[model samples]
Target: MTPHILVIDDDAAQRRSLKTAIEALGHAVHVADSDQAGLEVFRRHRNEIEAVLVDLSAPERAGNGFLRALGDLHASVPVIVQTSEGATHHAVEAMRAGAFDFLVKPCSIERIAAAIDSALKFTRSGSQGKPVRRARTGTVGFGDIVAASAAMGRAVELGRRAAQSVIPVMLEGEAGVGKEMMARAIHATSERSARPFVTVNCAVIPHSLIEGVLFGQDSPAGSGEVPGKFSEAEGGTLFIEEVSELPAHVQTRLLSVVQGGEIEPAAGKRPRKVNVRLILATNKDLIEEVKASRFREDLYYRLNVFPITIAALRRRKEDIPHLARAFVERFSSEQRLAKPLVIDASALALLTGYDWPGNTRQLENAVFRAVVLADGPVLGERDFPQVMAHMASVRASGDTAGARSAVEVGHAAAAAVQETIVHAPNPAPTVESPAPTRAAASGDLSANVIISTDEAGNVRKLAEIEEELIRFALKFYRGQMSQVARKLGIGRSTLYRKLKDYGIDPDDPQKHAA
Candidate 1:
């Protein structure tokens, strides 16, 4: 049987290029543009399909579902996720979700062939080939959480243990690290798995209605008659997200519920006995809040009985590969696509290197955008423009390792020029102004100082006056370009850019006449 590979990418050119390249490597290639289409093709030719090359760059999607589907159909069949530069967020997710390998876009033919060759050698140790093995219950724990790092492993271990008891479990971490998901997983594994599970994000609810929303409202104003989250989750789990955002009164109300194991309805309704278990999640520190008197100390103790702190993305970048892959599959399944998008190597490196101030949720949003707008199945550095731009800026500054030195140099130069102008000799007092002078200040040597103003009192553009200052400094410093740049309080490169912008000739220093 001729080894056939299925290439799933939205870009026609990329599909054609890969097909031609893979075929040249002595294997056949089948191409699909979307996840739905790819899955159909993979199922139809399940046995004939040797490997799958998927693009997981769509910020809005991932190819993992298709890959997972294909895996179930043919567990031995390997799925190679191809991503563009700056998109490694999905690499681990792909691997954890059962992908054979990960590759970056525009990778060499030899590399692709090598990965495919390895993938073909794969044999599943699991039960079946690719029947979407349900994650015990849902996408939360077990294989769902996708932990590889010790930090995450410990956090997940705690979460699993917290499921055994009906005690209130409080999850602490930066938002978007899947606190709610953990709550659900705990609910699924507990005795309350058959009961209802309700989630209430306290931060989003109106301050006035929070109590009523959480503790059954009895014909409350404007809200009509509504059961509180407590009643809704009776005999089940109630996950309160952003729990600290609840107002002081709500906190008191919640305290009663936790302490007395009952809830009081709005407008003086009878306090009702409730059997709802609490699963609270907060990005804020409950201990700190308790100390600050913002959160009740007693309530904090009750909820903190089973605390599981989900690690932030930055602290656990090792898990980025799995998290990224999981999100790719997660976001991709939500969209209607013919093929799974791939994140390029550069993208993966970018993601891995990023600080992710926004955590996993931020990564998910970026991936969603990449998936939705990516032209090809490839998500490269260009897919996440804003994030890549920040990363690039940080890289530029870090690369020099002494950008501060350059800035300091510019400031020193500008200070010298200021000294010459303010204390040198006043340059005969020009007719346009008073020798283009002003009081010296810190932080910005050139800013707020008068150089040349039009007769109409309109302030001349800073660049023009800056050019004049540069020319004046050059002549004053005797054609020393370095001196002029220093007196200007800006880096040499910045001075050069400014010089070019203002049409200043650094070679000819005597050219004044500002």
Candidate 2:
């Protein structure tokens, strides 16, 4: 069904432009000249209308009253406010009064479209009333979450369930999988939405200062300079990222918060009561850490009350187009680029082909880099050379058996493009070799070949095989990363990552070996 949108703007020309633009997006537009008229129209067609776009400056009492009234009336229908330069403060007040988001005057078509898209999503969310989509923020929300894969859908559902409770939520994922963003969304939808939301990076904060940074002291100045995150996030949320990086003592203190629901400052003699909804994120498996004694078992159990595992970017290839577009729009707006960058099909295909080792964060950064470097309005395959290289390698490797593992794919791509004409024994016991041995063959492609295999030649892990292949390629390429990477069927970046992972130094490994 076509989404219905109500636009309340006094300017006839502006209303026509908005209606045209929104209708072009396949949404039915209902235009009203004033807030009262808009409300009457909305009341008559409440169920049909999905979203409201209002000019905050048009209404009486500076728009907050109008927004409050709309919220009181519609309750669930999202209301987007538009403000001019001097009305930015009023816009903030409107948002606090339950406006979904505000658009500044002279806002670009892209920005307005993004805002409406978010609003429509929010409106749909309210209609669905799914518990998982509780995080309703002006920015990222469960509704705005770019998840096309089943894995991510499940994660979002779990996150929603976790948001309904005040218990600690533990998000486990790779480093770049947007754990912090998800935490924010969870907090935004939770009952503590009105309270302060604080974040603490356990990995970055100084070891000695962490305790005082978390648990506020009783006395002034000497005891604690500022209110700790617990006190700062009172009646709100405290999101602790890289929780596994916390020192043992700090972990113990956090465990106390989980168990006792109060904090005992190092300098304070008494335990102080603080109300905070705890949300912890980690890139490691806490259960494995607990088993290895690296993480406290009790603390892990407490935080793991509602565990959410985020799927890495590579596993959800279908979401690449959506995520890339979002990033392009977001970064384009941020950079103040005059024209929005458009990713061509070839560029998108390349983006979807490679395994993003750093996950969503890496893709976002890559898109940002592309947007920054891109000269043309249309971002072509050349706009992202790294993705192209990896895509080239991955496709080149598909000629043989399906080698989906990054390492194996890299090796297969290398084998496909390598100039050495090296040969290996028949991959299967009964299968004939593609090329004849030097003894039986003329000096053709078959004659100049050496069998590339593991030293043991038994069934070894693909990683071990890839390491040997990479070593051989580096030797053959003589430290030329481009040649080596191309031969290996991987991006130079991926090749570099593999080198670091395998500790392969093309130039000076012997010196560091000792």
Candidate 3:
């Protein structure tokens, strides 16, 4: 099937080039040279255009504003962004504002076509030749967790085993680790697979009203009463999240219900019996809470009867590549884009090194950002701005460490030179010539370069080499002096001295032009 695409760029040359490239792939293409013209084209062919490709650097209109316009237009039609080389943060923001995918500039035609295909596949999931799976019964199955890590695998194994028993299970982990998903999986695998799985966020419920919410409350005279989570979950599973946030009184009440298989309703005339199984989750350390006397020891023991601790993302860095691929596939399928939205190795490396303080949730956001901003088939390091920035900082820090090591080695070599001079025999104050002016080995030289200019012609070559190094240093430092000094292995003052000696101005307009 021919996929219709709209290409938006302020550069007429780029717009024409992209339109021709996309059309060459047997797809229909529409072109616009400005954001306003892009919107007009989108509105005119709203139904015909399956996707929109927007330039991130388009002038006279902010990318965010264009994204908002697209959102307001075909809300469901995919909008792919074309971003500059290093503007990942802008890409992420565009994703948050609803871009479908983004591509970096100077991308190949094949890559652009692939991105369009992936986006189309994402939007057309289950509509054409998609596979169907038989739904599993009782507790929720391990299907929703989407993990490929050994740590997560072990946790799922434990959960499956725990499902065989009717005991109350407690899941401990940081937020966004998919604890609730695991809880449902256990329920689906257990005897109560057909029963409803009710979930309640303990932290969201007020302490004063938690008892009524969990155990039901009777109506006033002549009024109807409502059932609480326990009654709603009868013959099923009650999954309580943020369990550690439950007040002491609520904890005691919950304990009685778990132990007795019954609960007394608020304003109750009689105690009601329930046959629901219980699953509790918390991101807190219950042991510490118990020690601090903030949580009930008895309640902890009751829920801790079957404990499963979910692993954090950092501990499972190896799973990132898989997760990233999965996310790409998911978003691609949802947006009706094409398949196998490949991520280049550099992009994958950036994702793997991220600290991921938000775990799976953060990873999802990053993937979504990449998909929305990517203009090509493959996602690269520039697709996720925050992640790329963090990775850059980490690399810069590593570079500094390498420089320090080099300086230490240089200092030790100088000390050895002093020792050699002192130990020389028949020291008649012989004057030694300076070291030969040979080209330094490629890798070993620090930022320092030896320039030998005789009375003539060497001046031009020396000037050229100095200009190149300065440009390299400036690019490496992103035009920051402190960073340039660190990369050059010179103190800030010494860098200034060299800059003057080389007849270069630290703040020259030509130097910072790029």
Candidate 4:
């Protein structure tokens, strides 16, 4: 279908050019000479217009002000700002002010058409809409997480409420849960959405240099230095992932940043004040870490002011079908499949029944694998070999001795089993007990037996499962653990233990090898 486009520019030539190009694409076009004219056109044909292409350099009117005004009009029309040469900052400003996309001036019709296509796609998909004046621009919203389960619904509600406040938000979940996604959603729904949403994976960076990377370091004697995540996320959010991994000294500095909104650079430099909303995520139990004296109690309280725990995927199994469909749709679009991919009931059931150790990430990977491996347009149970295997293991584990079925009751059951096996109960159950029998029924028992000889043997099976789940959750949550855990329904401590146990490092193996 031909999309209706409105071109608004002070320059008659620019307006005419854009109008002509838009029309040439078989789209209906309208022209407005100024911001006033654009608003009038928008009002007159508000229903007809699909998008507005505005010139950022329109005379006498600040592009930001114009965009801001349009935002105030409650116009759902996607706005694409046209920028003059060397106006990169202006484009970003426009984006901050609710412009859906930007086009550099002196560009060919091809580029304009491409930008329009992208903007229209974004609009039609309901991805970006009317400017959320008070909402943080890039902060993730409920739409981003795509959860339908009651637990997930509550978590999302909490996220929205947390976003409305300025308090530091602490997200606790398993490694594969969509923590970062939730954090981003909170940012998107917050007042700081228009500003940068900087992320610092605490576990990824070296412990020796976290402070400098997070707070920024001063330039050496003659060289210039740059600001770090704190300054970069000024007026927006500083998302710290795996926050429990932060060293005690670094935690002190981070606490100061969160409490006082300032950080002193290295080499005795003066402290620089910033206005970044703090969003911390950890798969580890900070409370436990605090007890162990590894995490600062003060810092914990500061971040815990607005604590949000994401439900694990297994707990929110009801949302699996929807999530699976979303993933299939996403991958199918990305891959440009000949036909839209469909997931049959059995395949979806297979997905819903399995314990997603990796949470949504694993689910997405399973879907991606199914999409890629499928010979037909529809994805069937056979397509997800890993998912099927996991399902079999879970079923077998549950049916073997029926000792409150660890695989069926979710992570709580697994934790109970782990405690039973590791702590050595008074009656030290024999192999005939439901625990060992169930473990044996599940293929994981064999894997556990193999790793039992290792120093970390007891944690091995859980670690491997956690690693797989985290990796899987990464795919769906796009590596955001809070969301992964929320979808998975496990505590962050459980998630981290698995990561450490499995040794599934996120860093590039090639770089390490080199």
Q: By lDDT, is 3 or 4 better?
A: 3
Whole-model lDDT values for every prediction: 0.65, 0.67, 0.66, 0.65
Residue-level lDDT tens digits of model 4 in 183-240: 8889888888888888999898999989888877756665767668887888888898
Alpha carbon deviation, residue 17, candidate 1 (Å):
43
Using all chains and alpha carbons, the TM-scores for the candidates as numbered come to: 0.53, 0.53, 0.51, 0.53
**Model 4 regions more than 4 Å off:** 1-139, 393-514
Candidate 3 lDDT over residue span 1-514, tens digit each: 6777888877776777777777777989989887789889888888788878887743233388877777676467766776543343354456546555555443445436656875677566722434333343333467656444334655776888898988989998888878888998998889898888999998898888888888877665747677788888889989999999999888888889878877876554677889988899999878768867999988888888888877667544435655776777677666667544666545765565565779888899889888877898878778888976765665678864322211111111121222223332322121121221112223446544545564684555766666567666654333444446666787655666666666666543124422
Model 4 error, position 434 (Å) = 31
Model 1 Cα RMSD, Å? 21.1
Evaluated against the true structure, the overall lDDT of model 2 is 0.67
Tens-digit per-residue lDDT, 1-514, candidate 1: 6788898887777778778878877888889999888888877887788788888755567566875676566455767776532344465456546565665433445446656775565433211222222343443545466554434555666777888888889898888887887888888878888899999999999999888788766563775667888889999999999999989988887888788887766556677899998888888767667767898888787778887767667545545645665566555555655555555545665566566768888988888888878787667778889877875686576854322211111122222222333332222111011111232233446553555778898889876676667765654443434456677787654665566567765433334423
Q: Kindly report which residue stretches of model 3 are placed more than 4 angstroms away from their true locations once superposed.
A: 1-140, 220-222, 338-340, 397-514
Name the candidate that leads on lDDT.
Answer: 2
lDDT of 3: 0.66
Residue 60 local lDDT, model 2: 51
